[model samples]
Target: MKKNTEKTVNIWDRLRQSDGQSAVPTDQPWPKIWQGAEGLGQDFEPDVEAGLKRLKAKIHAMPVAGARIRRLTPLARWTRTLAAAVVAGLLGWGIYLLVQPATPVATWAEITTQAGEQKAVVLPDGSKIALNSASSLTYRTDMNEAAERQVQLIGEAYFEVERRPAQPFKITTRQAEVEVLGTSFNVRARAEETTTEVEVTQGKVAVHHLIRDEKVVLAAKEAVLVANDQPLVQETSPHLNRQAWRTGRITFRETPLEAALPLLEHYYNVTITWQKSAAPACSITGNWQNDSLTEVLQAIAAYTGITVKQLTADTYQLSGICK
Candidate 1:
């Protein structure tokens, strides 16, 4: 017992003198040291196999000698944790964006006019549209929030667009699109007609053919026709009679009777028939404003020496020969 006590005391003394260095010599017997430590657990029976396994596990867990151990400060550990959290949040956000559905477009507000009926409307943007007979116009209700003010048109209509440089006004038809900034223009895109016409009465406008991808720019009193799959045709001097329905004015310059009759019929919403086998070769040259159909017919009879007779409330007939 005295010999064992002396051996344990010498081991402890050598460990204290070695400071942080490995105190046990390579040639020292490990069993002797283990036997001394077994007394620490006095009530437990120390199994040799279990004790060897535990010691081997501890040896594997220990860091290698002479290796530098860098200890992280509290702030560094917190920064690493925060960086990991941010990366995870960004990954989740990207997945959410990929799975979401697209937003839908806004609905349109529509206005229409029946046969021989004319209607006038003031848009939300303070622009004015005068719809002719058998016409339809549509615009988005949320036009103010949109980047551009856009309207779709069918049949004929006159537009007086309000000036907003940041938001341009656009008119879309079946075959053509017209864009402008503060302008007065007329668009004729009747369903029965194969050609669409755009006439600018004030300011300027750009016309594009939807199918052929042709484009033209027009100033005041200029016009363009977008025919089916054809190149754009621009006119420098558009006729004044194009807006006669709105202005209540009609003018004819050396226009044949056959050609002039259709204009009058459309303007008055009436039908005219010729009693003779063929229409007279006489041409008409006159201007009438706010004139009744009968009054205008009388002037035509005086000018061409033809007999004008009313067949019905909305019908007229020409019988006599041209002078």
Candidate 2:
């Protein structure tokens, strides 16, 4: 054994002195390490494979880089916490995007008609409203909801309310409130007019004053006029002409010229002024369906034995000038 060790030492010394010029056999290097390992095994156990497995286990169980571990500073800890919070927030937002149907935005609708112009709108509940000249209707998009089928009206509108017992429709005007389950009626609450009128052509309606709280229930062919602070007064005249303007017709059954002229002006959105205070007293009785302004004026002149002349685009004058 001593002789073998001397021979190995001399070989290594030669290799070092020659700077690897004298090449050593590749297989000869591990023999020296193996000899050292074999000497260590003799002190432990006879089974090399079992001892090696135990050593590997011990190495794996030892703490890895224990001295390199460092505690976070206050600022660093906060940064870590904020990063976790940001991740959690992103996760929550992603979950929110997965469920629940998106809600559509609620919108308000408004319709305004100028003079000589009219408009018709079908409400969300399938109810119909015909707005007359110089009229406005305001409503919301989500109107079909219970107690939400409400509309605000100004000027004149003919309403054909749909029958919804659960959702009673209500019309609010500046002068009064008209509530109905189902009704076809005409509401005239013009700002210039002295009285607010409600005439039911079909069905029934409950009309109440806004500021006064006085309520009146009117059925088909019934009409009421609500004046400020006064009790509700039923109109003595017939309600047949209540829906005349809707059909582009003016029906006068023994209606006086002074009163009929206003209806004609309202229907055609025109103005008529007389020069004399003592004008010809004549009553008009006819049905002018969808007639032009000039045609209506000529027909009126023929019926009243007066002359009609256009003063302007929207104005007409009456006199005995035409033969």
Candidate 3:
């Protein structure tokens, strides 16, 4: 279903003709005159009176329109030679494409972590990435010249990118592009967080908003929160939480129940919510260790007095008293 343009056909023909009966060297060291006539599909006749006499009487009689066949001229013979070169190069490129296997489509690497498990990955370029619990990153294992480093992160990860001065590393999502050069950062793009969050622990990064055509640069200890219709880059405050799931723990400092629910689900792989009437106003203030799902839920219920209801393998319902 690929279209072979006239240009392509002509180039192939020239390559074939140039091969002729004699076995040409694989090196293809065509004369400069032949090299010059590349794309124009020009033909060449030898100079010198005797060569021209033979060309005019024989194989060179018919001239392909718009293509100059070298005539016995003291004038513009070089023009036709240049055209020949152009055609040869195009043919060579075509041959290369035909002989070579189709390039493989790029895809992301798959990474998964068990409930309490973590992993560290050293990328092809020597960059180090750590994946946290219940997290995964998809990226191309093969690095090519066309695209440097590109990966997609789901859940949370800590990246220690290797320094590649010429190639800029890029992390892409459904909404944004995070560009960096040899920096450490944590990215959390959870399905629960309403927004994709990127926090830089060291070095500098630029986050570009895909929809708004906006770009924000973050320094060390800075973070950007990107959500649908809302994108913000703010100086990280002291009250800010840890972004790395592997090393740092999540903390709730009198935060509302609704705000804390998403984090709990992400870490424990279980869903927890609140009864309608008590949900918005109920606040939670406590430090939860890396405890089991039941223990964490019990602590929350002890503070707010809301009953935790388990619905299925992965779903839960919160109801009853909050006051």
TM-score of each: 0.71, 0.63, 0.60
- Candidate 1: list runs displaced more than 4 Å: 1-104, 275-277
Q: Which 10-residue window in model 1 sums to the lowest lDDT?
A: 22-31
Model 2: which ten-residue window has the lowest total lDDT?
A: 34-43
RMSD of 1: 11.9
Full candidate order by lDDT, most accurate first:
1, 2, 3
TM-score of candidate 2 relative to the true fold = 0.63
Judging by TM-score against the true structure, name the best candidate. 1
* Model 1: per-residue Cα lDDT over 223-311, one tens digit each: 99899988898888897688888889989888888888887887788999985544448778899999999989999899988889998
Q: Which residue pairs collide, candidate 2?
A: none
Candidate 1's TM-score reads 0.71
Instruction: Highest lDDT: give the candidate number.
Output: 1
lDDT of 2 at 197: 88
Per-candidate alpha-carbon RMSD to the true structure: 11.9, 13.2, 28.5
**lDDT-better candidate, 2 vs 3:** 2
Cα lDDT tens digits for candidate 2, 87-154 = 99999999998886787666778999998788888988899999988988888778775455888887
| Model 2 residue 248 distance off true place after TM-score fit, in angstroms | 1.8
Give the per-residue lDDT of model 3 (tens digit) for 97-145.
9999998887556888877678988888888898888777887777645
